[model samples]
Target chain A: AQRVTQPEKLLSVFKGAPVELKCNYSYSGSPELFWYVQYSRQRLQLLLRHISRESIKGFTADLNKGETSFHLKKPFAQEEDSAMYYCALSLMDSSYKLIFGSGTRLLVRP
Target chain B: EAGVTQFPSHSVIEKGQTVTLRCDPISGHDNLYWYRRVMGKEIKFLLHFVKESKQDESGMPNNRFLAERTGGTYSTLKVQPAELEDSGVYFCASSLSKAGGSYYNEQFFGPGTRLTVL
Candidate 1:
């Protein structure tokens, strides 16, 4: 079975402060990781993927195979960044179905 | 290009009543997916469709849930006699390409329908 875990239910940070949302996964085979965010009153959107290694909205997450983790990080938090973030994982063979974490709500206070 | 769209932004129904949620994926996207987030739980995959065909449905919780995509234009998920445990948000997503290779195809999501069962 594949599983994704977002340890924190909520993370509060002041504007311009650095933030990190922790995520861990368990999969026997190769894993595909992704970060998705849902802003207030908006649909959930893809933030970034481990395969791309690209930054979105100043947020980046590296998939560490050694630790079985994929933690999302941002140097500066913006009020607009306040949203629900989910870390997702899927095995290479079953990439069509995404297994998601419980999600962490980031509150960026101005 | 229009993103994925789901009808009935919110629905409230008594237990034992049926509810059907609709989803219209982005134009030209062959892949459509169904996911649900139950109270205090992670967003979980319910199924996947390739055009009008069911691709994978291993995640479906039970037979109470049925999904269909006619003519590959739009899809509908019907829940018969929804239970209190079914109250949560249901999300639909779509992707353009097949799953494989180094390139990761992004799945665009709809606003999602918040379902409340009494």
Candidate 2:
């Protein structure tokens, strides 16, 4: 079975401070990880993926296979960055079903 | 192009009532997926469809839920005799078929339909 764990339910930080959202997974095969975000009143949208190695909105995440983790990070968080972040794992099976972690809500205060 | 769309943005019904939710994926997408997020829980996958065929349904919670994609263009999820625990937001997503590469396409999600069972 594939499982994702997000230990934090709510994280708060002052504006311009660094932010890190932790995520860990348990999968039998090589994991495909992704981060999805939902801003207030907006639909859930993809933020980034491990394989893409790309940063969006100044956020970057490195997949640490040894740690079985994919933690999202940003050098400096913005108020707009506040959102519900979910870590997801795509199973190795043919269908590539996504298993999502319980989300962490980030609140950026001015 | 239009993004994925789901009908009946919100529905409220009593327990044991039957409700049908609809999803319209982006045109030309071949892979469609269904997911739900119950109150205070993570978004959970319910099923997937490759074209018109059901590819995976391992996440469906019980027999009271039925999902179908007739022409591969759109899909529907029916919950008959819904329970109080069935209240949640149902989301639909779609992606282009896998291109020849190590990376698969990103899925675009709909706004989701919020269902409330009293």
Please report the candidate that would top TM-score against the real structure: 2
Which lDDT tens digits does candidate 1 get at residues A32-70? 999999999999998999988999889999999999999
- Model 1 residue B107 lDDT score: 88
> Each predicted complex: what DockQ?
0.75, 0.81
lDDT of 1 by residue, B87-113 (tens): 999999998877556555788999999
Chain A TM-score values for every predicted structure, listed in order? 0.96, 0.98
lDDT against the true structure, per candidate, is: 0.92, 0.94
Best candidate, lDDT: 2
Name the regions of candidate 1 deviating beyond 4 angstroms: B99-102
Predicted structure 2: lDDT: 0.94
Model 1 interface DockQ: 0.75
